[model samples]
Target: MRCVIAGGGPAGAMLALLLARAGVEVTLLEKHADFLRDFRGDTIHPSTLRVLDEIGLAEAFHRIPHRKAYGLTLVTDTGASRLADLRGLRGGYDYIAFVPQWDFLNLLTAEAAKYPSFRLLMNAEANGLIRDGGTVRGLRYHDKDGEHELRADLTVAADGRGSTLRVAAGLAPVEMGAPMDVVWFRMPREDGDPGETFLRVSTGRLLVAINRETYWQLGYVIPKGGAERLRAAGIEELRHHVGRLLPFLAERVTLLGSFDDVSVLTVALNRLRRWYRPGFLCIGDAAHAMSPVFGVGINLAVQDAVATANLVLKHGPSAVAAVQRRRMFPTVVTQFAQRVAQKRLIAPALEGSLRLTRVPELARIPVINRLTRTFIGNGVRPEHVASR
Candidate 1:
């Protein structure tokens, strides 16, 4: 457990292999050791799906509990539209699958077993980062071990957007937008296909679907910390919110049952000004936190892992060299896309104008529908197989 990982997420787990395979012993630490049964980070994008295939985890990914998804769904106050039947995209991996992220991580955790050089430490909390002349040299972590300073050739902050390492290192992710958290629940299996998915629009409420399941991944469009008040208003108010959005869910709306607390995530994503400094580096949400809207977070995060691993394999000891080695691909893509996604994708929609007027209009535009289809369709591959 010499190569210290500040987080046990995908980036951290995947990084352990890259370092271990390179003969660097890795220690992965997690705040919460067990995966909770909840709805979170479900969409595995086409780009990321390919990365997993290349990493030799395709079978593991498929074996995880999940449902096959084809494309994105758009639902307005009136109706729904389908995008990119995934079976029809070119030069893009052509399929999107909806596996709960917790399950996916569990699968990766099991597969990390192939490498004995890797050690996973669960329930380990990283209190602060250790630095050397402005470079992060190590981490001070506490678990059953109580408190210990673990030394490593490198320290990676694969922690979440609220990264403790980032804070301790005094690096703030540039605020692109704010976290936009959601409260979501799934319906019991429907008799028929849920029909792609839906993005039902209404005042103070937003309902969306989780691909083909009878269940829909629904949300309320409220500011942060609004879930308790929503729950207090009772199920009837929530039901009323759903009824105005889609009549189809009228009978089934009750089936929404009870919604877990609405977790708020700032939708405004931020990328660290510098991804690495000397003996340390950050990856995944630790480096650049993205909004959940486009469902691109997982894909981008895995790509970060692959890129980091590749660089670590190519270079040794020098995180400077590793970062320099990775300078080309992943960093380039991350840099190139950040501004565009911030300005074009999320900002204009969230802050520029009232989202109410635009959502229905956007869903109705044939061009927009075509764009959604094209985006999702690209996730599918020409061979109709996922990358692996």
Candidate 2:
């Protein structure tokens, strides 16, 4: 194979698809047998929608059972405020699509299967890198049968935040520290429930309620390293917290019988100083683990894949550093914005100091409103599908 990509994520899957479409032999390794993991980053932003349009998959993506969010709303103790209105965005795809990550990945991989040069190895876990002196030859992975080494001209790691291949390549990301972690759980949704997804902020608690049609996939944000304290307080305490946050769900909060119903996400914000080493490159969560502030993780990873495929197909594996150079600015800008929100908004809210009275007015301001819409809708330096 010319290229071997570890991790069948947005980055690796999309890159493999593009390379195969351009007649390059690419093999993609996915440890999981299927893409059915829940509580993952599911927001597909406008920039990604535009890329799908370019690649002729926009209509197909829209076919999936998903919800369209035109704007993000912040509900505080006082009132709800508009964060970013996507209706004013330029592209036809102004709204963000909330589709299950599995559905999205399945769509991409299925499309890639059309190309003869593409190969997907399910249940193949890339455990280490295949090194040839200072360069990476490919990777060593294990499947159900046994351990095997897959050699190729280039190796790309899109494995995720806890990427084993990145560790094998002797690269570490700088930990930038997040102020909060999230406990995710689901509660039943009713006919009269709030329809739009919104972020709710109270004195010392922050919760996000995403309308997942039948159920509300909620994330209760707590202070960093606060999961232990939360569990110690007991599951009923968590039920009380949920009841206090969303009164409509008070009756159903009891459904959370124990901590087993919730998944704790230890938020980490970090990025690799250098994203490539010789024939190896790291992208997506492997390169930068993003905070779930604006829910831009999936979009940014797709953007990285688009940029990587455009460069690599045009200039071959020698363009590895150029991919990082092209993508680093957007990564830095997005992470900086997330860090700012963590410090100014989330941290204070968790500390019972910040108020949202000014947020509504500030969001209405022309300059800030326009910037917020552009930032959330298109992101920084959004990439397009380059024609081969």
Candidate 3:
């Protein structure tokens, strides 16, 4: 069977590698010339590690430089608490590995290059779907040279949240609404700095800091459509806010010299009511755009790729609906949890109500903490790599 996958993000690149390993002919197209973009999804959950181990790349994956967070730490106005103990989870790979996403993608593509059946076309952007009657048969894309067409028995859209192919195929995702957007930037980290990834919450402000060996990837959350106003207030205001919330970073917040250094990520929570057409299938963020609540988006996308490969390799394009059916439960469950957190926790905290204090209080309970860890670490119905 021949397949053409658009977008070389986590889902597209992973599915390509898996299919190529199974000796299937696959062509992967990436719009970007390189995978060196900043602040892409960097969290690699244990569930994804198990997928790598299944494909025999766990040890090699660990060789890449990364920081490990055994659990999530939460600090609020009242006190500090351990939100989830991932170390206690029942798995060989228990900790969340925070590695640069480019490293991860490069590793997958490099391994895929070993198989002659795998073809990667970088700097090629999929412009439209090639349709025969009402079914999609392939895609038309353009690289530095010119426009070109590739025909395949199956087409998969893994292009990300704002997928061009999905729109071209007339698939619209139901908007679930998000309450906040995030400003991401980097700050220096010293040797004795707090090691674990943690969230610091103060009245009317929320900050998430992820340890990145030499620096911290900081995410400052603000109410939806508030980024312009925040910029108007000046970068010094944001620096002062960060300093007031986490005193230790007071000296280094100045590293964010100007608003130019910050990048805005407008969060959205939505999913497609239908994930497939006659000859095409959509997976990953292409089908369901996830809010970055638990940092599980990448892991969920990886699972979708595994399930897609498992079914499609055996049943061909006829298995597309089965892939959607198997994945819908997890997508719905995770998105539901995100919506609840946005409504009850994050939104209230941003509104200065301090309802986020309940998170630490509830997390103190052993069973509640265990259950939270299980849901975050393993997710709902984690898929395993099936033999081709």
Candidate 3's displacement at residue 329, Å, is 0.5
**Tens digit of per-residue lDDT, candidate 3, span 74-146:** 8887778887888778778788999999999999999999999999999999999999998889999999999
TM-scores for candidates 1 onward, in order: 0.80, 0.98, 0.98
lDDT of 2 by residue, 44-163 (tens): 999999998998999999999999898889988787888777787997788989999999999999999999999999999999988888989999999999999989888999999999
Cα RMSD of all models vs. native, in order, equals 4.9, 1.1, 1.3
What candidate 2 gets wrong by more than 4 Å, as runs, is: none
Clash tally for model 3:
0
Clashing pairs in 2: none
Model 1, range 29-72, lDDT digits (tens) per residue?
Answer: 88886856465666776666666666677777877766766655
Which one wins on lDDT? 2
- Model 1: CA > 4 A from native: 90-92, 202-205, 212-214, 223-232, 255-268, 320-388
Model 2 TM-score on a 0 to 1 scale: 0.98
**RMSD (Cα, Å) of candidate 3?**
1.3
lDDT of each: 0.63, 0.92, 0.92
Point out the higher-scoring one by lDDT: 1 or 3: 3
Worst 10 residues of 1 by lDDT: 379-388
